[model samples]
Each structure stands twice: as structure tokens, then as C-alpha cells.
Target chain A: MIAVLAVVQGDIGIAGLAASGILVAVAIAISLWRQLGLERSLLWASLRALVQLLFVGWVLQFVVDPDDPLIFSVIWLTAMIGFAAYTTSRRAPDVPRVLSLSIVAYAASAVVVLGVLFGFGIYDLEGRTLVPLAGMVVGNSLAATVLVSRQLLIAANEQRDLIEARLALGLTAKQAFQPHLRQALRTALVPQIESTKAVGIVFLPGAMVGLILAGVAPADAVKVQVSVMYLVLGSVATTTAVMSLGISRELFTPSQQLRRPTQRP
Target chain B: MSSLDAFELRGVDAGPAGSPILKAIDLTVPANGVTVLAGPSGAGKSTLLRLLNRLDDPLAGEIRWRDRPLIEWEPTDLRRQVAMVFQRAPIFPGSVIENLRVALPGVSDERAGHVLEHVGLDVDLLDHDAETLSGGEAQRMCVARALLTEPAVLLADEPTAALDRTARATVEDLGRSLADSGVAVIWVSHDTDQLRRLADHVIVLADGAVRATGHLDELDASDDQLVRRSVGAP
Candidate 1:
């Protein structure tokens, strides 16, 4: 516990930590002054984020050590994937096999994205690069997976007659569901694509800002930011594609008949 | 097992498990002529029709299509043979020809025109956007799409319930003509006048059970008051 606190204190000195607290205080004060009814939530969320981030920082100090084996990185990545899957399953309890589907989606994106980064030697093969890169991939992919799972299920429910009409005309389940799946995928992916398009022009991304603040050259920071943006976009596309296809299969029976979704209460 | 029967159901229980809509139904659908399934709302007429094409399976008992169990046939093959037209007339996002091609992917423009004309639609509408079609035109287009598969049995589930009187007459005539050409037409109609006009055989359903199964004359003479009333018999 002391070691973790020491590490946190070294990274952000006590005065810097207090300065961050002041920022939260300002947010809470504004919430109260405006009667937004969000002061309590704002305070709680800020405190929780502080604690969680500090804990993660402390853990990463050891995990990213030069002496540590790559197995520790693998374990950390696996744990992140598992937690992401669990979170997605909780968010979409009605979707069948959502836990397994999420696991596959997150893991597939991480592997594919990380493989390109390291396989092509864009980044060093170490805990430092592996953990944060995979974290970004898993984090960005989570929302896309949840969006696609829910959207596909919604399409199945709202477009029941259309799907059944196609099925009645001797179309296979895949054929009947192709259009809806494409729609869901588009719905899930468009925001990511749009953000990717507007990344530098609209506003600087976090990674680029962090690099620039850390005194990296503007051109170097831009390069890293562009790579990160592409990876995030790729991860979103991969995760949504896997999730939408998996949910599409679950929406039908082996007989190619549309299985009516259990109505949400 | 008769060759004349298109579908034979024995002790079929359908719908949700605990609260089935069609309960213990034993019936036969003829392979020729128009058979109108007449009932009040919630009588499971549509449910029974769905069972014939394997859209929804029965909870218990068996359904045979042409002496073969429904489960034995490949769903795609079975559906191609037993095409259905829905009430709302779902139109895909394309021209009328593209919609027709959903059933027969390579359907030629000439063949598309012929089928459209057969359903009382102008062939000139073939190139128009399907979503631009009027409700009646869309419904007839759906029928034309079903016919593209060259199905042996045409299941019309309240196909004209949404159309105007003129449009209803047109669709009803199309069904009649299809049946006259030897394709078994199983139609569901809440309108007693339509039952009187198109029924060569009538299956009167009430609360999921078969109240009467015979010609319109037989239904008119039914001892069950609900059955007689279903056919609008005084």
C-alpha cells in the first residue's frame, strides 16, 4: 500500500494532486451553483476515477518493468478482455451468448490490432507498449460491441415482418438478415469513423495531448496520435463486425426461421 | 395420406408453450381451389397457416405436407413450395423488379412484367421504386413475388385486410385466379363476404379449435352457433 502511494506521489507530487482536486472542486461548485443536481455524482465519480487510476498506475509500474516476463502482459491483457466481456454482458443481458461473443470480439480486436503494431515492429515488444496499446483497443471496442449487440436485437424485433417475409420467400437466414446486419454494423461504426475523420481538426485526442505535454516534438506526437486513431478505428470495426455477425446467427434457428426475441420488460 | 390434401395436421398445439393459440387441431387442407380460414380475431387462423410453411412449429403432434412430415423437408425447399404473402405487404428497398428478384434472383424483366400483369399490376410499374407503390399495389406486388417461386401452395394471411374495397376485390380475384389455375390457395379472411366470395372450402376456427371444416354451405348449416355466425349465416 505504501509502495503504491509512493509511486503515485512520485508521478504526481502532492501539490499536483491537490491541484487536480481543485479542478474537481470547481466542477462540483459549478454543478451546485447551477442546481444541476449532479454535484454528488460528480464528486463520487471524480473520487472513484482518482482511486481506480492510481491503483492501475501502481500496478502498471511493476507490470511494465524491464525485468518482468511477457507472460505478465498476457495475463493483464486477458483480464482486461474478460472484464470487458463481463461488462458488455451486463449491459446487454437480453442478447444470447453476449459474454462469449464479447470475449471473442475484444480478444480478436486486441490480437489483430496489436499484431499489426508489434508484428510490423511499430512499437517495442514490452509490457509498457503492450499493456497501454491493448487497453486502448479494448476500451474503444467496448462501446461498439454493446451498440451493435443492442442494435441488431432491436432490428430483429422491429423488422420481424421484413425478416419473415424474406424467409418465406426461401431466403436463407444469412440472406434474410444481411441487410439488417449491415445496418447495425453501420450504426455502430459511423461514430468511430466520423471521430477518426475529425480527430485532429475538431480537437486533439488524449494520446497526442499527453505526448505533447510530455515535451515530445509536435511531429512525433502527431505520428503517434494518427497511429492510435487508426488502431482505435480498426478495433471498433473488427469488434462490431464480430458482434453483429454473432448476434445475427443467434437471432435465427437452425431451420432458418426467425426466432422471436424475448421482449424487453 | 390422400394426394388431394396439401397439409394434414393431427393434434397440433402451437403458439407459446403454456398459452397455445392453436390447441389440438386436426385438419386437412386441400391441394386445389381456394380454402378460406375464417375466424374472429385471436382465433389462431394465422398461427395455423404459419405451421403449414414451418414458420412456427407445433408444440406437440404432427403436420404433414403432401404425405411427408414438415420437419423432413428442407426449410428453404419447403418455403419455396409454400410461399406466403403478409398483410402489410413488405417491400424491400428497391424497384419492383428487384423485389421480385428476391424470390427468383435472375427473374427476367419480361417474366417480371408477366407476373405483375397476372396480379393486376401494370408492367410499367416494374421499374418504379417499390417503396413508392400504393398500399394496394404493394400488396399485389407481394403476391407477384410469391408467385415467382412457382409455389404449390399460396398462403395469404389477411392479404387484403389493409386494402380499399376496390383493391380488396382485385387481390381477391388474383387469389381466385391462382387457385383456379390449380395452385392451392389457403387464405385467412375476417370478412365474411370474402369467405362467401372466394371459399371453395372453409375452415371455421374459434379459440384455436376447428369449429367447422367444410364447404361454405356446410358452414352455413353448422350446428355450432359461432361456426354458423363466422360464415355470416343467418
Candidate 2:
């Protein structure tokens, strides 16, 4: 794939390869230094991601060189979105397997939000335009899912007796969980809101950083960053909402019983 | 003239080391009145009370409530209709109303206030977090929570042991009043004086078996060595 892409798109030479290798080594050293006393899992995950990304970079060189790049890009992004949904739901068994719904919700929201801002004849489907925006949406949604699931689980466990008592007192299961459910949803969304508030002053986000590095003007990079931020926020909210609703329904039966956690043999 | 005898224990044996806490015990408490389980420490009094609520199942024989075997009772329904107050009050975190609300979902704030009053708790204490309440106040809230269910039986294990003398007397009074209002009260306590003061009938246990069963006065009149010794007779 890398050979084919080199033939098609001119050469991305040994210089590019050396730069990537040197950047990766530096990133690893920095991460290991920062995580000095922590568990080895972080270091292990970084190494795995590096190897996986290199493999993916080789494969994408061919996939992106195809006659129909748009279709290939759609397929690639769809796979990312689908896997994000699956990983998030599996992490929270209490969440319903709304894989299809989450995919549609996230993909449709991301495309609309990203496409309008980028596809408005202002920006085109360049690698710089598409890849970073998708990464923001996919990554944020995964984190949101984690936050939502952890908060919901804690709220549910802590208030179990109160929930049972409420059920006995003639409230439906949904009614019993309503307060905590709302709280969990709020907790999941708040961090994203705070980051959005901190956009230019507290930190320059990844999209702007990448665009600025690629020699785009500061104002232009900030504009693209703003659009990407909206896409990310929208996609994550839709995915989290659909997932939260589905997970709540799946975790509890219509008769208001909690589903037993799936046991392994 | 009752809502059916809500509980029955027959040949029930429970305790540690194969030595039953309540051996071959048979009891049918009336649907109303304070049924004091008066015994010394380790006499299986608490165990017998727990069995009524199915907190612990009998080792041998059976326990039934409303003609249905205790084991067959739906756990949720059983819990709702039969509330157990532990020896030391276990107040879960949350407001006083939240603690009271634990047994009855959708119980109105007004009704919670009423139940609190009925359990001898001041209405002002409703919004206070239960964990911070004094032992007596917490125990009263436990009773209030149980009462909110309109439970057929209240199984209390040493509900006042951790309270001061004034608080203990207050809780004992509340238990008697609850029985007077037509709820079956099965209370376990080692305080013979409180049992005599509050119980309509007493079931005394020495080891795991019933050593004496009758009204408090009858037990007092009897020549049982434990009772004689307990009464401080020389």
C-alpha cells in the first residue's frame, strides 16, 4: 500500500520517515518520564498505539490512493465510529448495545457539523481537514462515554436502597433513577463545556495546533478549530445521549428489574 | 379479628456450630401486640426475630407468614411488608426524609412527617441527614421508615441498646405505641426491665431453646433458675 501510494502521490521520502520516527521516540520518552511511578499499562498502551498507527498508516496509503477516495474515507471513518460505539458500550454493560443507533447518531452529527464548516467551499477534503476533525469527534465521544458510564454506575449503586424503596412506593424504575440519571448525564457533559469555554486563553486545542503547524494562518486555524470543536461537541453529545438512553433501557427490564451482568464461563 | 396471623415459626432451629439458636421453637404471634423476645446475650433472641423477616432462614422446620412459607415469599414483597431494624441503628447516608423514604417509594413529604411524628421523631428533623442523627433519633427514623410501609410486623433487634437511658426509654415507648396501633412488634432485647415494661408476652431463651414462654408476669412468677437469678433473688 505504501509503495502504491508513493507511485500515485509522488514520493513521501526517507526524510518524512525519519521525521516520524524521531517524533515518535521523543513522544514515548516524554510519556514515560511523565508517568514515572504509575502502572506500566500507560507505557504499554502508547507502544501498542504506535505500532498500530504505523500499520494503519501503511494501509491507508493504498486506501487513500484509490480512484474513489471519498468512499474509502467514509468507510474508514465509519469503522472508527462503529468501533468507538462498541468499545464504549462494552465498557458499560449497563449501557444498552445501541451500536447501530450510536453509529448513526455520531456519524450523522459529525458529518453534518464537519461537512458544513469544511465543505462550505472554504475548505476541501484534504488529509489535514478530515483526519484531525474525525479524531476529535471519535476521541471525545469515547471519553464522554467513560465519564457517563462511571457516573451512572456510581449513582445507581449508591442509591440502590432508595431506588428499591421508591419502586415499592409506586414509582416506575425510570422514575426512580431519574435524578441520578440526570446527574450522570450532566457530569459527563460538563467537562466538555468547560474545555470549550477555555478554548483560546487557557489552551490552544489540537486542530488549531496542527493547522498552525501546517502553515495555515492563525485566524484561519482558529476558525477551523472552532468548527472542529462544534463537530466534536455535537457528535459526542448525540452519541452519549443515544447511548445513555439505550444503556439505561438495556440495564433494566420493562418490569423494572436490573439485568444481571453478563457472566463469563 | 386480624389481618390474618402474618407470621408463624415452627420447630425453627438457628445458631452456630450445629447448636441451634432456637431449637424446635414454635411461635404464632397475634397480628397485633408487642411480642418481646427476652433472653440473655447469645440466647438466639435476635436470630428468632430475624427469621420472622426472613433475614436468616431457619436451619430446620419452617417459618410461614399469611399461610405462605417464608422461603417462598417474594424477596421484594417480603422486604416491603417486613422491615428489620438492626441492634445498632444503621442509618444510610441521605436526609432524614430519604432514610424514611427507603421503605416506601413516592411517600409524600407530608406522610413522612406524620410517620416521623408517630415514631416519636420531631418533624423538624425530617431534612437532616440521617447519618448525623443521634442513635435514638436514627433508630426512631428506622422505625419511621418501616412504618411508612404499613408493615404487618416490625422486627427490631436491640433497637435501643446504643441509646442513653432517656433515649432507650423513649424508643421503648415508641415500640409499645406501635404495637398498640395494631402492628405486630417482635423486639429482641437483653434488658429484662424494658421487656417487662413493654411486652405483652415474653419468650425467654437460655441456650438456643425456649426456656420459658408466657406473659412477663407468668415468667416472673415461675421458679426458673435463670429468671430467679435474673430477678436478683437470693
Query: Which portions of model 2 show Cα errors greater than 4 Å?
Result: A1-50, A61-138, A147-187, A212-265, B1-5, B8-30, B36-114, B126-132, B145-152, B155-158, B161-165, B188-234
Worst 10 residues of 2 chain A by lDDT: A1-10
Q: What DockQ do the predictions score, one after another? A: 0.84, 0.11
TM per model? Answer: 0.94, 0.61
Per-residue C-alpha lDDT of model 1 across residues B1-234, encoded as one tens digit per residue: 146456889999999878999999998877679999998899999999998898888899999977789999899999999999999999999999999999999999999999999999999999999999988899999999999999999999999989999889988999999998878899999999998999999998999998888988878888888988889886
**In model 2, what is the error at residue A151, expressed in angstroms?**
4.8
Interface RMSD of 2: 5.9
Candidate 2 docking class: incorrect
> Distance (Å) between predicted and true CA of A119, model 1?
2.2
Q: What is the C-alpha lDDT profile of model 2 across B20-126, one tens digit per residue?
A: 66788877755568877766788787777766655456779898878889788765577567766766675656899877665665788899998888888889998
* lDDT string, candidate 2, A49-120, tens digits: 868988988867755553546766767777788887687657755544545545655676567666765767
* Cα displacement (Å) at residue B115, model 1: 1.1
